[model samples]
Target: MFFSFVLCCLCLSVYADTDAVKSVSVMEGDSVSLESNIPEIHQNYIIKWTFGHPENRIAQINKEAGIFETYNDVLDGRFRDRLKLDHQTGSLTITNTTGTDSGDYQITIIGGKKITYRFSVTVYAPLPVPIIIRDSSHCSSSSLSSSSSSSCSLLCSAVNVGHVTLSWYKGNSLLSSISVSDLSISLSLPLEVEHQDKNTYSCVINNPIRNQTTHLDFSQLCQPCAIRGCDSAEAVIRLVVTVLVGSAAAAAVAVLVYDIRIRKAELETIQTSHRPCTHCS
Candidate 1:
C-alpha cells in the first residue's frame, strides 16, 4: 500500500509539471483564454475547469450534448456570466479579469483515462504614474562646488505595486531598476544625475501589460542659470541688486507720503490761523 501511495504521488508530480500546464499573465479588466492541451475533444469525454483545488469546479462541458455549465456557490462566487468554454477544444476564457481572479486553474478531461491540465494565471493592476521628486532637503548653496552644482539628486516612488519593475532612465538608457517578487508594497528608487541639457531623464513603472513614465526636464529642475545662458554668480548678484533696488524705491515712496502729510497739516494750520477773525466779525 505504501508503494502504491508513493507511485500515485510521483504521477501527480509529473502531471503538475507537464507541458499541458500553461502560465498566463494579464492586466486587470482584460480577458484571457486558457487553451486546453488537448487539441481535440471526443464526444464521450467530459471536460471540467476548476479553480484552486481540483474539486472547486467553475465550469464544465458536455461534448455529447453540446452544453457548458458554470457553477455558482463553488467559492461563494460565480463565473457564469464572464466564463466561456470552447466545447470543441475544451478551452476556457475568462473576461474582465480582476486581481482576485489570480490563482491556479485546473481542467480535468475524463475519457478512457483522466487527464488534468493546470494553468497559473496572474492578473496585475495597471501601474500608476510614478512620482519623481527632487531632493533639495539637504542641498545648500554655500556648500556647493562646481562639481556639486553640476549634479542633482532625485527620488522616484510608487505605491501598492506588485510583481513589477520601477526603473530610472536617462533618455533610452536605463540607469537603475528595482522589483519585489512577492508582496505588494510601496517601492522607491533614488538617483543622482549629472546635469545635462540634451538628454532627458525619466522614471518608469511597469508590469507585463502596461507602463508609465514620468519625464524629467533637467533645465527646469536642476540649473536655473542654464536656461538663460547666464553665470550662476551673476544671477545671484542680479537678484540681490533687484531686491535692494525694490527696497530703496519703497523707502523713497514712504518718505514722499510722510512729506505730503506734513505739508497738508501745515496748510490746514495756516488756513485756521487766517480765519481767526470769527470772534472779531
Candidate 2:
C-alpha cells in the first residue's frame, strides 16, 4: 500500500506538468502556426480545435490522411469562408476577422495520451476617425462674474473595436472624459481663461489590440459665448430711454398749446369791450 501511494503521487505530478500549455496571440487576418514537441508515434493521432469552449468544436484533423475536417453546423457563418488549416504544419489561418471572432481557443491532441493547448486570440479593426467640437456656455452667473470660464468637448470613435477607453489632455493636463462599450469616446473640459491655457487639446483611445490619437488646435476650439445676456440688457435699456424721451416731448407740446389758447381768448374779450363803445357813439 505504501508503494502504491508513492506511485500515484508520481503519476499525478507528471500529469500536471503535461497539462500546462502555452497561450498564443494572433491578430485578425493573420496566419498562426502551432507546433508541439510531443514524440512522433506510428499510431494514428487526432488533432481537434475549438473556440471559446471545448464543446464549441471548430475543426478536427483526420487521423489517417492528416487532413482538416470542419463541421458546418458548429462553425460560425462569419468564419465560414475565412478559415483554413494546414494539415502537415498544424497551423490555422483566419482571413478577414470581425470583432465577434475574438475569444479563447483550445487545441486537443489525442493519441496514446490526451494533450491539450490553450490559445487566446484577439482581433482588431482600424480605429475610427476622430472629430473635435467646441462650445462655450456658462453654468452660473458667479462663474461669469469672476472670469470667463471657457468650456469644450471632444469626440472620438473607432470602426470595429469594442470596450474602448478614451482620455483627454490639454497641453499634458488631463481633463474630464466619458467612455462606453461602443467605439466612441467623448470628453468635456472647463478651462480657466489664461494666456498659457491657449494650448491644443488631444484625445486618445486604446484597447487590448490597438491604439489611436487625435489633436485639435486651440483656435478652433475657442468659441465665444453664444447667449450674451449683457448685450441683450444694453439693447433693452436703449429702447426704454427712447420711449421715455418721446413721451416727455409730447407732454411739453400739449401744455404750450393750452397756454396759447387761453391767451387768445383773453385778447378777444378786450377787443369786444372796445367795439361796444364805438356802437354806442
Candidate 3:
C-alpha cells in the first residue's frame, strides 16, 4: 500500500510539471514574456520567479508588505536592468535576451492557493545573409574535379551564424544543406552545374523564424570557357604563313648558288687567258 501511494504521487508530480510548462522562443536582442495567469495581484499576495536547476530567486512581488524585488545581480548581473514585471498579471518580461539567458523559468504564487508556472525559453542569434562564390580551388585543380571548360564550380556560404541551416536549391528542388548550432560558425555547401544551364538556383540561410536567399547568376559568375584548340580561320592563317616563309627561303638559296657558280667560271677564264710560256713546248 505504501509503494502504491508513492507511485501515485510521483505520477501526479510529473503530470503537473509537464502541464504547467510552456515553450517560448525569441531572437537575440528581443524580449520575451513569461505569462503568469495570476490576475488581480496585490501586495497581500506573493509572486516569486526563479530560474535554472537550482532555481535562484530572480524576482518577487508583494503589495501589503511593500516588497517588489528582482535579484538580477545573482548570475554575474546577466539579467541586470533587462527584466520587467507586470504587477497586475504577475508576468515577467526579459528584454535584450541572449543565448545565455535561455533556460527554464518558474513562478510560484501564494495567495488564496499556491500555484506554479514553468516556462522554457530559447534565444537564438540573428542569421547572417548567405553568399555564393565560385570555388576556385576546384576550378583550377588538375584532376577530374577541375571545373571543366563546360562546367561551373560554386559554393554557398554564410559566416557568424548560429542555430541555422545553409542550403542549396535548384529551381524548387533541394540540392544540399548543412546546419550549425555553435555561437559563431561558418558553413559552406558546394555545387557544380553546366555553364549554359538556364535553370534557377539559389542559396539560403535560415533559422526557424527568418531566412535569407542569394540567387545564382550563371552568366555573371561562370562565363563560357573558350575551347583550347583553334578554329578553322586560325588554322588557315597558320598554313598560309608557313607556305610564304618556305617559298622565301627556297628563292634565297637558289640565288646564292647561282652567284657562286658564276664567280668560279670567271676565275677559270682569267687563268686560261693569262697562260704564260712556263711549259710552252
Candidate 4:
C-alpha cells in the first residue's frame, strides 16, 4: 500500500508540472488571446472557460451539440462584447483589455480525458514618457555642492504610472533606477551630470512589456543656461534697489542745500538789523 501511495504521489506531481499555470500580459486597450494548448479536439468534447472563480463561466463550447456561447452578461457585464472563442482550438480572446481585466482564469475540457488549464492575466496602462527637468532644490547658488557649478542637477518624473521602472541612462549605461508596483502612482528619480557633458542621456519609464523614453537636451535643461533665470531675477532685484537708493540720496542732498540757504538768509537779515540802518541815522 505504501508503494502504491508513493507511485500515486509521483504521478500527481508529473501531472501538476504538465498543467502548470501560464501568465499572460498585455497593454491596456489592446487585445490578448489565451490558448488551450490542446493539439486537437474530438467530437462530443466540451470546453469551458471561467474567470476569477470557476462559477463565473465566461465562454463554453459543446462539439456534439454544436453549441458555442459566451456569457457576455455575467460579472457585471465587464466582459460584454469583448469575449471571443476559437471554434477550432477552444482558445479565448479578450478585446480592449484594461487593468481591471487582470485576474486568474481557468479552462476545463471534458472528452475522452479531462484536462485543466489556468492562466494569470495582467494588463498594464501604457507607460508615460519620462520628463526630465532641472532640479534647483539642491542646485541653487547657496548649495555647497553647487558653489563651483560644475554639474547640473536633474529630475526624471513619470505621472500616473503603475508597475513600472523609471531610470536614467547615460550613453547606454544605467546611472540610476527606481521601481514601483502600485497603481497609477507618480515617481521620480534624480541624476547629476557635468554642465558641459558631451555624452548622451535619456530618461525611460518601462513596464514588463513596453517602455517610453525622453532624450535629454543638454543646453535646454542643464546648468550655465539653466540657472540663468534665477540669476537674472536676482539681478533685476538688485537693479531696482540701486535705483531707489540713488533717488533717496539725491532727495536728501537737495534738502540739505535748501536748509543751508535758508539759514544764510536769516543771518544776513539779523546782521543788517543789528548794524543800525543808514535810514535810521
> Which candidate's TM-score is highest?
4
Off by over 4 Å in 1: 1-20, 78-80, 145-147, 224-281
- Candidate with the greatest lDDT versus the true structure: 4
Q: lDDT per residue, candidate 1, 45-100, as tens digits? A: 78888898645888888878876787766765756478888866788999999888
Model 4: CA > 4 A from native: 1-19, 143-148, 225-227, 231-281
Query: Which parts of model 2 have CA positions greater than 4 angstroms off?
Result: 1-44, 139-146, 149-161, 170-200, 223-281
- Estimate the TM-score for candidate 2: 0.56
Off by over 4 Å in 3: 1-20, 42-44, 141-147, 227-281
Candidate 1 TM-score to native:
0.69
Ranking by TM-score: 4, 1, 3, 2
Prediction 3 global C-alpha lDDT: 0.78
Query: In order, how many clashes per candidate?
Result: 0, 1, 2, 0
What lDDT would candidate 1 get against the real structure? Answer: 0.78
In the order shown, the candidates' Cα RMSDs to the true structure are 9.4, 16.1, 16.8, 12.4
Give a tens-digit lDDT track for model 4, residues 81-102.
9999988878899999988899
Say which prediction, candidate 1 or candidate 2, comes out ahead on lDDT.
Answer: 1
| Model 4 pairs whose backbones collide | none
